[model samples]
Target chain A: MGATPTAAVLDAGNLQQLLDILQKQNYQTVGPTVRDNAVVYEHIQSVEDLPRGWTDEQTNGRYRLTHGKGKKFFGYVHGPNSWKKFLYPPARQLYAADRMKHRFDVVAPEPSGIKPALIGVRACELAAIMVQDRVLMDGEYIDPEYKARRQNAVIVAVNCTRAGGTCFCASMNTGPRVQEGYDILLTEVVDSHGHYFTVETASEKGRAIAAQLATSPASEEQLAAARQAVDKAARQMGRTLDLTDLKDSLYRGFDSIHWEKVAGRCLTCGNCTMVCPTCFCVNVEDTTALTGEQAFRIRRWDSCFTVDFSYIHGGSIRATDYSRYRQWLLHKLAYWQDQFGVVGCVGCGRCITWCPVGIDITEEARAVKG
Target chain B: MASKKKPTLAVWKFASCDGCQLSLLDCEDELLAVADVVQIANFPEASRAVKRGPYDISLVEGSITTPHDAERIHKIRRMSKTLVVIGACATAGGIQALRNFTDVRRYVSAVYAHPEYIETLNKSTPIADHVFVDFELRGCPINKYHLIEVINAYLNGRKPNIPSYSVCMECKRKGNVCVMVATGVPCLGPVTQAGCGAICPSFNRGCYSCFGPKETPNTEALAGWLHALDQRPDEIVRAFRGFNAYAEPFRKQSEAYEK
Candidate 1:
């Protein structure tokens, strides 16, 4: 129950209070810190573990970190590293075998002590977690490792009061503000007056954390301030896309001649899908060791753009760049919604921002849809 | 009294994801019964318990991309009573056929640590290129239900009821709008095969042909329409030369637009 909201500014002194609250609850704190010049998600002990005075500028084929105005908790869109890396790990040994007296028994790996209380998570990133949830947790075949990691974790979502030029969460219907999936949601508001946050609890775990913290009841005025700040961020959003009847739009455009145009620029490098939070298609490899007795199976992320992703017995069926390019567009915009009811894109703009050639999906969609 | 003979079933892999075989395991309820019906002769992905082949039916995944693989398919053809190539990889050489456009040497060097350690053909070919395949299942990832259909057809001696029509037929059947004509979304449903139930264009995106081209595809006409949508000739060629780039009609069309 989100009774009275809480208002607090952890100005240097309150930094210790934040750590003590997390330590008291015995939840491992995870937040952003400078790793290889990029804000990477990792474990945190205190305020020093946070990415202080660091912000990000994102656009197609460009991502740069800027010196923040002052002390800030979380200020990044996303990085090469995602929560999925820690949750579903890039390469994980699923099970180990120990031959008994008669047959072999499977032993599952124990959970890594990563009960992370994610601090300063942006709304778009939180939406990403939900999209991944539909793929990993909600699917008929649940990833056992992902289940363990997600079940033990706590999510703290924050509304983005600032949107750089590359963001398109509004178009993707993902965010400018955080929504229901988070356990706790915070909105950052900075002005000439001061920098502060308006925090709300979504889940019971969030409520428990609030109880442990040295926070007082928030006034209605502070709550209004959070709403106004969120609205301002919404107005300043970087991009917008007309998603109405998009599925039907693609359905009728099968031979619309737009794909050939797109195929010209699409390099098929797969950077888009690699960074995409919900693209769950994977390729499995079965490797046999020298002894033959030692063999193991592994799963790795695979993209439809890759030629090998669509191989056939005789050869590839979609044997042309046009077809493969169309397949990805269709899958991302059309078939994804058909299968999952929700559009595949979360509008984090990682695909556009990370694409080597700066092939903007929004621009592509507009060209084809028009 | 004569003992009831169980049908011997084997799952095989070539150059693809183990998903299709995993589909058998995914059928948790049917798996034990599947194991019971078939001797479960071979399936490296699931169980290590290898019962030697000469299998009654071999469901092969992936494609022939090397000299060794080409030779191996022949041995498999000899051993298997009924051979079914599953997934796009097995039927169309998968997405690896993208290498068919460029030098395989360059590709191997680009992807591998040591080109000397890697062994590959000039082109990634399909199971049908080297040997007679009993049946070829389509899709970047083959449809599991259709997979069961192929298996059932072999078990009972019937032709698989797979439609060879365009995706447009399915879209019309499902009451979906014509994406290309209606919304101007460039899709590939017109000439592409009718598998995947016309799922992509039904949404807001274009159809990337995963099921490959249909019988006597009018790829030339399709390319013309694509050009009208402001696509450059090279892009149009690249589109057709992608996942199923080695397939004849698409391959020819892609080459027609080559830079």
Candidate 2:
């Protein structure tokens, strides 16, 4: 439709123009912002809202933001909140109804007006989004709300130049560099020459937005530097989950003693599932006004670690913590592939960093494989 | 519809603070709507008017700390169609259950001028221990919305949609950064129940376990982390021995750490 999408270089100072253009297109920009001592995704109006000169130190059961010398916009890795919060929200009202002369009138929720421009999306997070797209959109029972929000949203993916201590995106083959599934991809480069972003337009929409910005053809040297930064990140991966027969090992490791040991330490708090980018379980509930005149149906995110998550007619199927932990680990590594034709985990390491007891999934997988 | 008699509700109290009953009164706007659905037959906190026993719903707040109240609960249980114990006092014996771990007479002799005059039981106990409780709503002072939810569920003949999951779930849902993970703070959120909506962590403080131990809470595991965070074993013991001290999981965990 237009000049073929090409790689270009935009100075760091001009990045704010991209935000303005996205806003002009009526897309609310949501990106990483430091909140409650950790970086979290929320609505942002300006590029200043992005975490600058800050990198995160994340290990099992720990996370802290460390401000550095240089001003790197997407300096840190992804945090607890993911792009799913903008798409598959934590809680939402499905419908409302009111009694009217023996017949109840149903009221559907108003269509969402906020079309989010998700900024600073990492490769692993993009992979997580793709995994969720397969689960929510490509399934027989389509989630209409997810489908609508996803179609409306725009992605601005950022290739990782530095990996957190808990990150293993390299092992997952999902990150360190943006491979695919992005409208616009950016690789941050801060070198002796200057600070800038090597941008690559993957779609016509991305090219149209880039055409509005002040950009030049990225030099061969700048592109190489960007590539080197990503390669450095790949080598700096702090953890790794060996994928060789990972699903088969998990399937056969059902009764392993490791499950019991993990269960003993596991609080069954559901923190892992909540922080996970791809955990898409939810429970629906109905509430009536005390007057009994109105009723509402709401859905909130649920986790398998909860006792009620596996509740049946008599009692919960996964009554023991051992079984529950085993089920979650197996499902993430084993059953997910059987059902969806892809592994569930994206190796973003949110589960490891957010876990209060420091349960490393990689270590658990290795122990299970034994 | 006029032929349908509204369900009669009775609010009763025992030896404890009336904060849980105050929670019902705190439902200022919703109280009017609640009144329309059910008859506020005998709530001493709200009105002077008292109705006869055999109430449709008996909301019990507080714990049995004396022989008189212990006997009184059985009678109330016989009269109530559905007896729901509200708050930590009625559900887990409240903070007064600390006396359960030690002799009650020494404290009585120390506080009261005349020990003979004080009539009390050695062990404070929850209503469930003395009588059959239909439901036990957990919290130091029960969440009013949850109280309303329990009432509504009872009226609709459905199970109450109260979550027994950990407070971490609520903290995550609120998009809160983990205080324990980020800082080396000792938090009870991982082992504590979710009813309080993680108010403490949202305020950048650790949870106080006001909602008690969640379903399948691994207190041993949490204690180990607390120890690693520089909390002494006694401090960990004291952490579990709070408002919900007598709750089975907390009691056992505190006892284990006591040594």
Name the best candidate (by TM-score): 2
For model 2, state the Cα shift of residue A169 in Å: 1.1
Query: What is the C-alpha lDDT profile of model 2 across B1-259, one tens digit per residue?
Result: 2357889999999977999989888998888778878899999889999999789999999999998998899889999999999999888999999999999999999999999999999998999999889999999888999999988887766778899999999899888889999877789999999999899999889999999999999999999889988899999999999999999999999999898
Q: Show model 2 residue runs off by greater than 4 Å.
A: A1-5, A100-105, B1-3
User: Over the stretch A5-106, how does candidate 1's per-residue lDDT look in tens digits?
Assistant: 455432333545766787677877777777645566777788787777787776665566677776666555565445655566555666555545577566
Cα lDDT computed for each candidate against the true fold:
0.70, 0.90
Clashes of each: 66, 0
- lDDT score, candidate 1: 0.70
Model 2 chain A poorest ten-residue lDDT run: A1-10
Docking class of 1: incorrect
